[model samples]
Target: MSTVLIVQFIALAVSVLSFGVALWLYTWVKSQPSKNSRVETIAELIRRGANTFLRREYVVLAKFAGVAAILILLFIPHPIWTGGALDNILMAVAYLVGTAFSALAGKVGIQVATIANKKTAVAAQQGIKPAFLAGFRGGAVMGMAVVGSSLLGVTLLFMLTQDATTLLGFSFGASSLALFAKAGGGIFTKTADISADLTGKVELGIPEDDPRNPAVIADNVGDNVGDVAGMGADLFDSNVASMAAALVMAMSLDNGTPGKNVLTVFLYAALGLLASILGVGTAKMGRGGSPTRALNSSTYVTTAVYAAITALATWQLNLEWRIWGAAVIGLLVGTIIGLATDYFTDDTKPPVRHVAKASQSGPAFTILSGVSYGFLSVLPAMVGIAVASFASYLITAPLGAGYAMFGIAMSAVGMLSIVGMIISNDAYGPIVDNGRGLVEMCDLGDTALEITDSLDSAGNTVKAVTKGFAIAAAGLTVIALLGAFIAEVNEAIVTRGLNIELLTGFDIMQPDVFFGLLVGAAIPAVFSAMLILGVDRNAQRMVTEIHRQFKEIPGLKEGKAGVTPEYDKCIDIATTGSLKELLPAGALAIISTLVVGFVGGVHAIGGFLTGNIVSGLLLALFMSNSGGLWDNSKKYVESGHNGGRGSDAHKSAVVGDTVGDPFKDTAGPSINTQITVVSLISSLMASLFLTFSLF
Candidate 1:
């Protein structure tokens, strides 16, 4: 067998091993103690509500995917009547497989997370160590499943078809699922979160996660859908897109050795997965250790391991050393970006404290301070992405024609090499967050609540860091995808017997390109606004339902025995409203990309994608960091830094957190998927645009 086949088989083996580890972690989490009846009851309610939302969400997504598949069959890459039917069929099948694998990863995450919440709550009664382990392990299941499935799917699909275009179809499938999963799940989560906070904390003066709040169950369920399932799909999309983009560029390289670039990507990705598995295995906190420290340490360990292994592989395989350096550059920049995000969002940092101090004056000051910090926070990440892309391109430009772009793709892979660990840390936030809520609702002692609170706080900090990292990775991946788009367009022009010389890159001097650039820059802003507004509208409806329950349900506020507020009603409302609101926002993104492509052809689409990446990365970092800063500020205030809970400062901080919720959760993360979807769509439809356009 060729060395390429050997490397592919090795990647497949590692993927299978990762999946096995996920299964083992799931069983281990299940084995943890969960004997409390009240905890069981509440956990079951959260589980059922989460599952119900997912079921309905998937049904709607199925219809969307169906229509999208039909279109792909008819028009993508080529017209069906042009004797490209088999390839189109393969592309459609690959697309469906992408959606199915992404959905399955999310489903697995939700199942394990719901079970782990109850386990973590029960373990919290023992001490912080066990509770931390339960939450971290539960989240690890998602981390492993996502990375494993993404790697396995990409490798297997490529092995079967050996076609980079088909891989683009698979990546598009993942992007489509991510769009709905992230947006729909975001709306569902924030709607429940805002309604629960508004009525339960602001109006009633009750504590958070109070049993009397009708929306409390929905709130817990939202954590699973939004943070666990939604985030899993987001990262899955990024991971798949990174691999597909790299493979596409590698296929176009004029290197003397065939398959060298392809094998290098596979080897790097496989090594990264191996590194993450080792990091997850070794992650542990000693007695009384800080959860934050433990999480950060594990991330550092993964980065180190990935660097060492990939360096060794580069030496052994005789690959381009500059490309390896580019990957390291990406990894280091990712770490730097994460640290910058932590500085803005961590409670131990000045940004959160500054926001908390500003809250003493009023909500306006809180908003002003948080927004300013949010904007400032964008600088580091933006610089990091720009530096990584530029440095990688420079590092590999001397090698050959297309190697520079391939190096940038490698950098994205390097940055996301430890995504398995990042997902674990990110998912841990929601699991422990749910643990805190469960501890309160089940009436666990103050000791248990305190322990879970600390764990949850660490989860939040790590989550902020991971969100920054994920966005940066996606930004780099889409940049790589843009390169792939150019290559695809050139290849189509050649295959169709056109006499035109193959184009190398987009020219900013073109009028149509400039026009598309201007319009594309506005897309992220409008898309974000639509999502945030949907949250606003849906939250109002759920808040009204909460008010009605309090007024109509006799003795619910008084905690009358045997009288429960209608929790199911609130869950249903969030479910219905989220699905309703997500469609238009998704449609807007898809339709806009098509309109630009049809109007101005590939050059315009090129300009459009560049504008989208620039603005999308800016808004995503700003929103995510600002929202996290506000959240940590609220927590800092509640911890007695600026007067304890219920103080004027606390109230003001709550308002900031409320505003930041949708910014971080719904709109910020969803933009990453929107950019990827547009890039892939442009690549897949390059032929049509190249052959026929008004401009």
Candidate 2:
């Protein structure tokens, strides 16, 4: 076998090993004790609700995938009539595989997280250390499963098809599922969260996670579906996109000979997974260790491990040093972005505390302060992205004029090399968030409450960090995808024997490019608005439902012994609304891409991707940070600052949190997937756009 094939097998081995680790972690989390009947009952409810939402979502998405498959078979790469039926068949099958893998990764996360949340709540009665371990280990399952599956899928697909373009079809499939998983799950989570807080906290002054609140269970369910499943899908897409883009470029650079570059991509990706496995294995906390510190420490360990091992491999395997530098640059910048997010979102940090202080003046001041700090927070991340992308490009430009973009793609790969750990940390957030709720509702002693609160708080900060990290990675991945798009367009041009000059890059001096840029920038805003509005409309309905339950269900509001609010009703509303609203926003993003591509051709798409990247990054950063700021500010108040819970300031902060719920959880995070989806769409449709466009 060629060296490339050997490296491919090695990458495959690493992926399988990661899956083994995931299985072990899942077993470990499952074995953790869960003794509280109340916690078990409620946990089962959350579990059931989450599964219901995911099942319905998949059923709908299956229809979508089917239609997409037909389209792929008929038109993608070449018209079926053009006598490329074999390639078209491969593309369709790969696309289906991509969607299936992404969905399975998400399902794995939900299954483990549901079990972990219950165990974490029960374990909290013992102490924070055990609970932290339970949550982290559970989340590690998702982390391992996602990165493992992406690597495995990419490796097997390439080995089987030996075609780089086929990977784009697979990526588009992953994006299709992710767009819904993120947006749909976000809408569901925020709908329940906002309603719970509004009816329970603001109006009736019930404690957070109070069982009497009808929306409370739905809120917990949202944590699993949105944060666990949605986030897992989002990261899965990013991982796959980064690899697909890199491979597309790598194959071109390698030119079918013994190829070091492709080997480097697979090996680095495999090693990154290896590093995450090590990091997760060592993840632990002392009895009184700060959960935030433990999580951050494990992340740092993973980063260090990846860097050291990749460097050694570069030397031993004769991989290009410049590419290594680019990858490491991406990794370091990702770490820096996470720290910047932590500063903005951590309650101990001034931005969050300042927002909390502003809440004393009422909700408006809270909003103003959070928004200000949020905008400021974007500076560091933007600078980090700029520095990483430019530095990687410059580092690799020495190799050849054509190598710079590939270098950037490598950087994204490097940055996400530890995504297994990132996903673990992220999934841990909602698991512990559910744990915090369970403890409160079960009346676990104040001791357990304090432990869970600390874990949940850490989860929130880490989640903000991971969100920043994920968005930054998406920004890098899309830049790489842009490169991949140009590569695809040029290949298509060659194959079609186009009379026109081949595309090197987009020139914004052209009118079509400018038009696409303007339109592209607007899409993020429009997409964000649609998802947020979905939450708003859905939340209003849920709030009304909540009020109706309290008014009609005797003793529900009073917490009467035998009277429980109908949590199923709230879950059903969130499910129905999320399914309804998700498609329109996703459709808008996608349909607009098709419109722009058909209208302006490849030049417009180049500009379109550019504008979408710039504004999408900005809005995603601002909304995510500001939402985190508001959320932590409320937590800061509840932690006995600003007159503690139920005070006027606390109430105002609750309102701020409500406003932020959708911003961070729904629209903000979803933009990453939106950008990726459009980028992949542009790549997949490159040939059609070139051949058919009016421009």
Candidate 3:
């Protein structure tokens, strides 16, 4: 068999292995004991609420995906009447499959996470080791599923179709789903989180996760939907988009055949997944090991293993060292970005400590300090992305024409190479956050509280780092997509027999390119505002509901034995409000890309993607880091650093964290998906844009 065929089989084998591991992890987590009747009942309520939100979200997403698939069938890659009917049919099916796979992975995360939260809390009574193992292993299920399905789906689709254009259809489908899932989930989460914090912690000075607070259950449910499911979908979309972009370019450079370059891409991606699986397997906490240290160490192991294995593979396969170097640069930069983000967001770091100190004065200083540190935190990640792109280009440009761009694509693939590990780390955050809440409200014990609290703090810090890592990867991924757009446009130019000059690159001096550039820059800001505003609007309603519950229900606030806050009511408010607000913001991102493509054609799109990526990366990093900083600062105060819980400093820190709720969780992470969606949409619609633009 040819190397490509061998690699394809190997990829499939690796994918299957990941699924096996995920199954084992699931079974293992389910076996963990949680016999507390109260914990069980509350966990059931959380699980039900989370599943309800996901079911409703999927119902709405199904309609969107349905409409999108039909459109892809009719127009994408070509019009139906122009032939390639088989390709169109497969594209639509593949698109739907992509959505289904992404949705399934997310559903799996919710299922395991809800169960694991109870297990982790109960196990914490045994000590941090068992609790940590339960939480980490539960998250690893999602990590494995996401990367495994992405690898399998891409492999099978490519093996069957042998058309890169079809992969774009699949990617666009993933992106479309991810965009809405992230937005809607973010809205749902922030609404409940902000309401619970303000009403319970700030207004009434009640403990967080207090059963007397109606929004507490909704808040816990949001952790699953928004953080676990939504973030899983987001990373899933990024991994697929990066691969699709690289494969599209790899095919052209290989003269549309399964050449050495093509084999290299498959091999590298497969190896990356294998490394993450090992990393997850080897993750262990010491008797009193810092959860942050344990999590960071696993990521380091994954990174080292990927680098070592890829290097050996390159030598054995006789692949170009230049390309391997480019990939490694991307990998190294990704690690640096994560570490830098940890610095800005981690509680042990000066930035977070300073932010906590600022809260000593009041909430105003808290906001100002967080915003400043957030903006400052953007520099390292941005610089890292730029360096990765430029260095990868420089190292591989000598290989041949188009190789430079492929190098950047490979860089993206390499940067996200350990995404299985990244997602494990990322998902660990929310699961443990939920564990902390469950432990607190279930009255598990003060020991359980201490363990989950430390784990939750680590989760918050690591989630921010991973968000930065993801956005940086998207930065390179979208740039590669821009290059793919050019490849598609030129291919279309040849097929249509048009006498136009094929685009090499967009010139910003042209008015059309500059117009798209300016418009694209504004889109992320507008998108962020809409999402944050959605949270603002929904939180107000939920807050009013929270107020009504406390005011109307007898002795609910006083923690009377028979009094229970109506948790289901707040859940309904979040579920209903989120679904209503999800579509508009995502529609704007996709629609703007279409408008730019039609109004100014391919050149405009090239510039538009550029502008959108730059703006989106900066905004995403700032919001994620700053929000994380504020969150950790609050934890710091609550830990009795600046001041103990219920102090003026604690209240001010709570305000800071509250303002940051939508910033990091809602808009920041979603923008990464938003930009990827725009890039994929542009590539899918490139032929139409080439043929029909008035300009």
Candidate 4:
């Protein structure tokens, strides 16, 4: 084998082995440690104590420094063992640096949080509106730190390996800085979004007359700054999904030469940022009552970008053996786990008032409403994943055979992972919070409370479903990484034997036949749209039922002032129209992916897929936050604008929030945390797969 390929294989092996050992150790420690017997079993106790110690800040720094030193020692060129030590050392350094960078970035994140707190104080004092990005300035700071560290680390690694250290170091340094800045920014952005969700959804409550509402302001600061900015950081800085694109780009480079800019770093970053913004806007679609189920815009855009990038790298740039088929399989398995979890946990049962307010249309409406509601709540996310995956293939037609298929598989995994988490969180949070809100009211009798209590239990199940998704994501990420490694190894063996026909089933052409491709692309959108409409219709039925119940209750009369039918109708209209608005996002994804694919060739599919998945995840998170902020803002604004405190308007704000538990923070940040972990797994898994082929 050539020296470079030999090095690549060695590096890949080391990464996979090291990661496996670390993961196994972590899991074993977690499962075996006794909570109550903290001081027992000398060896086991020592191991537990050691792990705890390692997690400490100073200890972590020392470990990182030690790993760095080891890399420097081991990366030296040698003839021993076929000159493979250099490759293994290089791979080790990559992991060590990545780990160190992540740790340092976290410290920076803490500092950013402090700054946000200070800013919030200043804003409160100055009577300025609180903006999400003021807090997100911390994320920017973290991004800058990560970028700086990554650049320095990569430059040093390169310097250690090359003969013309001075010249190569300078060029590599500059290029690494540019790439790291963008990549680190994307990471920090996702972290920031998670942090914000942690604070906004869990730590804080909806305030009276909050200015963050979307309806009152033409340019809501939260949506523009908090949601968009945070998402941008996540996609650019933290996302592993982008790694596949990066690998494809690197593979296209001329013999690993340091000269040309192989990657379209700027363009990809822009697309990633766009995905984040789109994600924020589309988050509301996940809500059961909102219009449109086909999938969020983020997924469409991200998948397209990933595909386009891969296609360009392969067909136009002539890159080869860049796709990870096993990773795709692992992802599929994980998605199935997530979907099963969501299916059983989802609650579509009628509320207590359903019987009292039953429509003359009878049980048929009830069943339809239940089915519609369930479909609406879940279908958009699923469909979005499917569409994003299929569209990625169309965008990679020119990348020869295997690459396009791999892109689709990766996209499918990425999008599904994201959607599963969002649905899980949203479904769980509302019900729990709604119940908590009722408890806090102290107005309901034991009987009414009991009914709501049942609703709350159902909500917990929803939360469990989300947890199941998280479990699946973590499992799949590991599996995908392993799968990708195995596939690469197998492919290498086949190539060494000069065998071309040993590749597995269902290559790139399966999803690309005229009707098949169209169907694949359209199905998600169509299903999602149908689901959204169904949810809306179901919600209207419930609202009408609730209204009738109130009217019929002899002793439980409506107050002199309550939301009028017209007001309820307006809410229905807003939600129903949202789906139609969401359609444009999917359109953009499809159009953009196809256009980019046609021009760039099939390998560009990697780029489009990466972009779409990143976008979808970001969008899902953003939309949820934005929608919540808007809901809260509207409540506060209406209360203040209609009249001062104690007015019916004010009361409504209190009651609406209290009853709905819209933000779902009443219990804790668990739901937001759930989504955050999901995001983290996506990034980690992407990295694993992308790096596994070549370390």
Give the winner by lDDT. Answer: 2
lDDT of 2 by residue, 61-165 (tens): 999999999999999888999897999999999999999999998899999999999999999999999999999999999999999999999999999888888
* Candidate 4 residue 389 C-alpha distance from true site, Å: 1.8
After TM-score superposition, the amount by which residue 640's alpha carbon in candidate 2 deviates from its true location, in angstroms, is 0.3
* lDDT comparison, 2 vs 4, better candidate: 2
lDDT of 1 by residue, 638-682 (tens): 888887788889889989999999999999999999999999998
lDDT of 1: 0.93
Encode model 3's per-residue lDDT on 1-695: one tens digit a residue: 88899999999999999999999999999999999999999999999999999999999999999998899889877898999788789889989998998898789899999999999989999999999999999999999999999999999999998888789888888888988999999999999999999999999999988889999999999999999999999999999998999999999999998788888889999999999999999899997899999999999999999999999999998999998998899999999999999999998889989989999899999999999999999999999999999999999999999999999999999999999999999999999998899899989899889999999998998999999999999899999998899999999999899999988898999998999999999999999999999999999999999999889999998999988989999999999999999999999998999999998998898889989999999999999889999999999999988888999999999999999999999999999999999998898889999988879
Candidate 4 residue lDDT tens string, 1-695: 54333333333343334234323423322233122221122113212221222233225334434643463335322222545565445544544444445444334333333223223222222222221212222223333333333333433444355321121112221222222222222222222222222222222332211122111111111121112222222221223322332332333232345322223222222222332223323333221221112122323443344444434534553333233222233234434544443343332322212211221233343233323333343343344344544555555435665445445434434433233123312222322222222222323344433333333333343343433333233222222222232243333345346443432322334322232234323422332333233333433443343345345544322233322222223222322332223233223333444343344322233333333333333333222322222233223323244443444333433333222221222111112222222222222222122223221
TM-score of every candidate relative to the true structure: 0.99, 0.99, 0.99, 0.36
**Would you list the clashing residue pairs of candidate 1?**
none
